[model samples]
Target chain A: MRRVAITGAGTINPLGHSVQATQQAMRDGVCGIGELDIRDVERLSIRLGGQVKGYDPDSRFNRQQLALFDRFTQFTLVAAEEAIAQSGLDFDGGLAAESGVVLGTSGGGLNTQDENYRAVYEEGKNRVHPFIVPKLMNNAAASHVSMRFNLKGPSFTVATACASSNHAMGQAFWLIRGGAAKVIVTGGSESMLCFGGVKAWEGLRVMSKDACRPFSANRNGMVQGEGAGVFVFEDYDHAKARSANILAEVVGFSMTSDAADIVMPSQDGAARAISGALKDAGINAEQVGYINAHGTGTAANDKTECAAVSNVFGHHANEVLISSTKSMHGHLIGGTGAVELLACLMALKDGVIAPTIGYQEPDPECALDVVPNEAREASVAYVLSNAFAFGGLNAVLALKKA
Target chain B: MSENVKDRVIQIIAEQAVLEPADVSMDQSLSDLGVDSMGLVEAIFAIEESFDITVPFNANEPEKSDFDISSVASVVAAVEQFVAEKSA
Candidate 1:
């Protein structure tokens, strides 16, 4: 199998709007979560979120594109532009035909859906926006990304709840490794911090009313976040031949289904994916120096994830520097793993470990070293990013230093 | 009213566990009866809806939650107390 290299990366998350800026935020342990500024915020019980503040859609897109693109799609295009620009590779002729786009988003055009639903239900409107269907479709982000970049090969979207981005990126890696596509523009975007979005989650009651403090004893719940993280995954040989700057090497990826419960995470299922990723990467547990955990600041996820890591790495689990950037960026839901991957890259490229901010006290159940409340410098050869989603879907990615 | 609440709570929990009311042991934990986290949540929802009384349950911190879910009898007792307090 061919090795896949991440040549370029970009993001517009609550932490920052670019790769450098986001990394700086991670280094400084900046918390982007605060009072949400969505419409009808007062109506929802949960008003705090990690919103992409100071973002101006008008400055990025024209009237026509704006009309066609939803907030999530716009985020994808913006992030993808940065990634493609950094990759310094143009898709044309055979390359254009072979490349594609795959993205993950739980709430595709949720802002559009919220508006139309309000228009018909609240305002009793007889008609809605004509482009609502296209804008609100789950594949809208991936389709728009493909159209923007002239990627005419295999293009699709993944919607496995929170594990969407990991699942999408894992598929992209396999496609490249299997000689299917030389390059795949892949990542995820989500912009669900709207009235209807928060209201829906309010029903589930998993949201934190205060803050997201992953692995902390007093942690309330997960906080919703919005943004996008896109990357250019290319064949390693192709990138090397072109002298492209490789950010990290995608060594291994594995996905598993718990087949157990809808929302409850299974330790066995999570451990399988974690251990499977190491085995697929052909590396032992001792080589893994860091892990970007799916620590959602919820009781079940933190403890379950810690137990799974312990089960997989044993004594090495206590040594591995594991942290949840979700404590800083909030839970991006579908787009989370994509943004969290940035932290994994930081560990490899920058030799810096992102901290799990907002940690007040440590729980014995989650007794692993969480890199609590502050960033640290560490040179690690291998890092793993874990994403365990609702519906018992698990995706784990193993990355190596470039 | 006490007897009604007990029966309703037992029936809701039994339904969630996919067991007959007679088969459900009051001393058995929800997990022992095959009620996973989602099942427990659904049972709580059902209990709340049936009695029109809110149960103070947190999915994340089930152990810390005021509503006891250690066993069927404990859940029933907690519901009965909440119901009585509501009527009082």
Candidate 2:
């Protein structure tokens, strides 16, 4: 089987608008969550969120492109451009035909849906934008990415709720490893902090009104965030042939379904995916130095995830340095795993472990190291990124330092 | 004010719990009526739509919500207060 190498990476998440900026913020323990400045803020019971503030599409794109691109799609293109530029692999002729795009997003073009819904339902308007259907569709981001980059291979979007990005990236890695595709522009993007989006989440009643402090005893619940993270996942030979700057190696991937409750998480299911990923990577529990946990700051998620880690790693659970970047960036829902992958890269490439900030009091149930409150320097050779969605979907990826 | 608050609230809760209004007891809490988290949220939405009132509820801290949900009767009283305050 061919090996997959993450040759380049980019992001425009709540913490920062680029990979360099985002990692620097992670290393400095900067929090990206604050009072949200979305439309109808007073109407939402959950006002605080990890929003990408000061974004002006007019400055970055033309009017026609802006009309066709929803906020989520715009984010995808921005991140993809950065990643492709960093990879410096010109997709021409055979390369262009062999490349593809795979992105994950739960609420694709939700901002477009919200605007059009309000126009039709609340304002009773008969007229609507012609691009509404294409713009609001779930595949809009992935499709736009293929078109923008001239990718001609298998291209699609994955929507597995919170685990969307990891699942999508796993598929991309498999496609590359199986010699199916030479290049995959893969990651995730989400813009679901709109009024309707927040209202829909509010109906679930699991959102935090104060702050997102994952694995903390005083934690309330998960907070919504918005942004995108894209990566250039290339065949190792293709990358080496071009002498591309490799970010990391996609060593292993595993996905599982609990087939249990829809909203509730299962520790057994989560533990299996973690152990399975390590097995797929041909590594032991001790090889994993850090883990970007699926800790969502809710009572059920934090303890359940901790139990899963303990179950999978056993005695090594106490030794591994685990942290939730969601503490600083809030929960990006579908786009979360993509952004959290940056933290893994930081550990592998930059020798820095991102901290779980806003961690005030530790819970006994989640009694791991957690790397609380401050970033730490560590020479991590292997790391695991975990994403457990609401619908019992679990995706875990094991990455090795390049 | 075509229907009383207690009767209407019971109807909504009964619908959420998938029980007949006759089987729903006002003294029973939402949990006692077998209204899970999703059902509880739906029941609250139904109450809001029926009474034209916002329930100021957040599931993360249900205990801290200004509107009470300790019992079916408490929910009715809270809705009645909001309705009255709306007119005032």
Candidate 3:
């Protein structure tokens, strides 16, 4: 297996569109949650959500590209453009044609689906939009990215609910390690702010009526959010040969299945993923200094994640500084792991750990020091980002200082 | 429809659109207050729920609205007209 390094990254999130702006917002402890502004579904009780503001799809793609891609795919393409520019790789060159593209998304083209439904049902229209098929599929985002950059190597979209991005990133890391591709553009995208998407979650009954308060005593449920985070992963030596800027090393990745309830999370499942990543990296549990938690601000998730940490690290759990960006950005579903991983990498690079905002009162079940509300400067060598999704899917990624 | 029914419908539209009680008047267009045609559809939905009446949309009508509906008096007249037609 070959060592993989992160060459570039881009994000379109609530804090801001660029990666720098997002990190600053995290350090400043700004909350992006606001009242929902989606069309036609205002009567729903759950009104608060974190939406990516001021995004113009017209600016991202040309008319021809827009006709074939969905909104999620458009987000992927836009984010990938930023990442590709940062990597300084020439996509038209043969080198990039062999490179691959893999992305993850839970609600792909949900906005398009809702629109199509309304057209057929409410408007009494029979003919569907020509782009409906391409817009509604999970793999469309990856396909669009590959075509946009002319990448020819293995490419696909991973769908494991919230853990989708972790799975996508993990697969991309392995592709390079296995010598299948020298470079891979991998990440996740989500646009669940659409009225139908919001209404679907409303049926789940797990979304908070108020704001997201992760690991807080007053926490009710998870808050929905939308965005995309993309990364360019290349072979360490390949990046060095080209004098590419290395952000952080993708040390190891591990995934596990809960094999139990579909909606409920399990500490054992999460612990197994942590242990697997540590084993893969050949690092002791004590070597890891920080954790980017999959803290969804829900009653069950925060407690289960804490227990999972305790089960894996034992006494070292207290020494480790943990935080959740979800408290600031809300839960971005498939995009959460990618965004949180960037936070972990930034923490390892800059030594400034992002805060878990809105944590006023701590839950006794969650005993770890969550670095609440205020960003703290700490020495971090190895950081782990955890993404445990619905249906017991768990994925973990470890990033080391480059 | 009775004047009280018209008033109730107008009140629901005003509240749903986040407008002031006095801002909504008869002959005033809803689109001028940033409530576009789709917003008007949602406003009608809310009003229907509040008044326990089903407000129907004319399929042949143009997508865009031509008037301003900022004041309650004007909105009341529009709802009254729709209600009277439905009953007839």
Candidate 4:
């Protein structure tokens, strides 16, 4: 198998609109959680969220184009634009045709589906909108991304709840490693922060009351966030041939299904995933310098994930740095892993470990070195990004300094 | 009252259902556009939600066998009738 390298990455997150801004915010230990600015919050219990500020679709797409895409697809396009630009690899020749896209999301076009349903049912309308079907499909983001850049290879969106983006990126890395595609624009985007979407999530009862304090003793639940995180993945040889601006090398990818429960997570599944990723990379547990944990700040996730990490790394668990960026950026759901991967890449390159911002009093169960509330400066060669979602889906990726 | 109701109802219907402003004339047949039974139900839901008014009668099941809900005028009249019944 060929080695895969991350040439570029981009994110439209709550902390910042771009990768550089978000990384700086992470380094400064800045938290992006704030009061909800949505139109109607009085109807919902959890009003606060990590919504991306100043995201105007009209800024990127024309009126006609905007009519065709949902907010999620619009975000995917915006993030992909930045990723392509930063990759420093022009697709003017045959490269464009060989490139593909694999995007992910849990609830594809939930807002669009809800709106269309409301329009048809409440407004006494007979004819549905022409763009409703196109907007509501799960593959809309990947299709739009591929079409925009003239990428002719395989394109699809993986839907594995919160693990969707990690699964998408993992598959993209494998495809490039297997020499199926020269480059893959892979990531996840979500904008399901509308009234209907929030109401549905409220049913889950995992929303935080105060804020998302991952690994904190007082951590209530995960805070919902909306944004996009995309990365350009190419074979090491291909990227080196073009002298592309390499960001980090994807050393290993591992994904597993717990097969036990849909909502409940398992420590064994997470440990297996971590061990499998280390084995895939031909590296031992000691080589992993940092772990971008899936600490969703929820009661079950933080404790189970911490146990899983301790099981895999043993004594090194206390020595290795672990942090949950979700504390700062809120839970991006499908986009969480993509943004977290970018954080891992930044940590590997800059040697600055991002803090688990909301960590106040650490839970005894989560006894690992969570890097606490302050960002730690340390040289890291390899970093792990983990994402475990509902339906017991687990995806882990290993990244090395390029 | 007839003109105002027709104009307001038609605009809301067109915008919600994504119909062309011109296509939502007073005489267009909604059923002809392949928007069968479910479409009618959704149209009622949107009308109620957007206008912040509940239409009279259980939209869950329709008693009328052959109500024409295709045009702007018919929908306006239906909503007005539903409104009047609730008010009475």
Q: Chain B TM per candidate, please?
A: 0.95, 0.93, 0.58, 0.59
Q: What DockQ does each prediction reach against the true complex? A: 0.40, 0.52, 0.02, 0.01
On DockQ, the candidate that comes out on top is: 2
CAPRI classification of candidate 2 = medium
Per-residue CA lDDT of model 1 for B30-85, tens digit only, reads 99999977787788889888988877776766677789888889999999999999
User: Which scores better on TM-score, 1 or 3?
Assistant: 1
Candidate 2, residues B1-88, lDDT tens digits: the string is 6258878988999999899999998789899989987788898899889889888876656777888998988888888899999889
Model 3 per-residue lDDT at B78: 55
The model with the greater lDDT, 2 or 4, is 2
lDDT of each: 0.92, 0.91, 0.83, 0.83
Backbone clash pairs in model 3 (N, Cα, C under 3 Å; residues 3+ apart or in different chains), count: 18
| Residues A1-402 of candidate 3: C-alpha lDDT, one tens digit per residue | 789999999888887788888999988999988888888756666789988889887876778877777777777777888888999987677776569988989988888898899899989999996778877888888987887788998898899999999999999999998888999999999888887888777655567866788888777778888888999999899999999999999998999998988788898999999999999888978999999999898778899999999999989999999998998888989888988877887798899999999888978999899999999999989989999999899999988998
User: TM-score for every candidate vs. truth?
Assistant: 0.91, 0.94, 0.81, 0.81
lDDT of 4 by residue, A1-402 (tens): 888988888889888989999999999988888888764678877787898988777777898997888888888888898998898866668988778999989888878987877778877788787888898888999998888888888678999999999999999988888888989999998888888888777655567756888888777788999889999998899889888878899999899889988787899999999998998888988999999999988778989999999999989998999999998888888888888877798789999999998778868988889988899889988889999989899999998998
Query: Going through the candidates in order, what fraction of the true interface contacts does each contain?
Result: 0.35, 0.52, 0.00, 0.00
Worst lDDT window (10 residues) for model 3 chain A?
A201-210
Per-residue C-alpha lDDT of model 1 across residues A65-157, encoded as one tens digit per residue: 988899999889889999999999898678988899989999889999899999999999999978999989999989888887889888899
Q: How many backbone clashes does candidate 1 have?
A: 0
**Ranking by TM-score, best first?**
2, 1, 3, 4
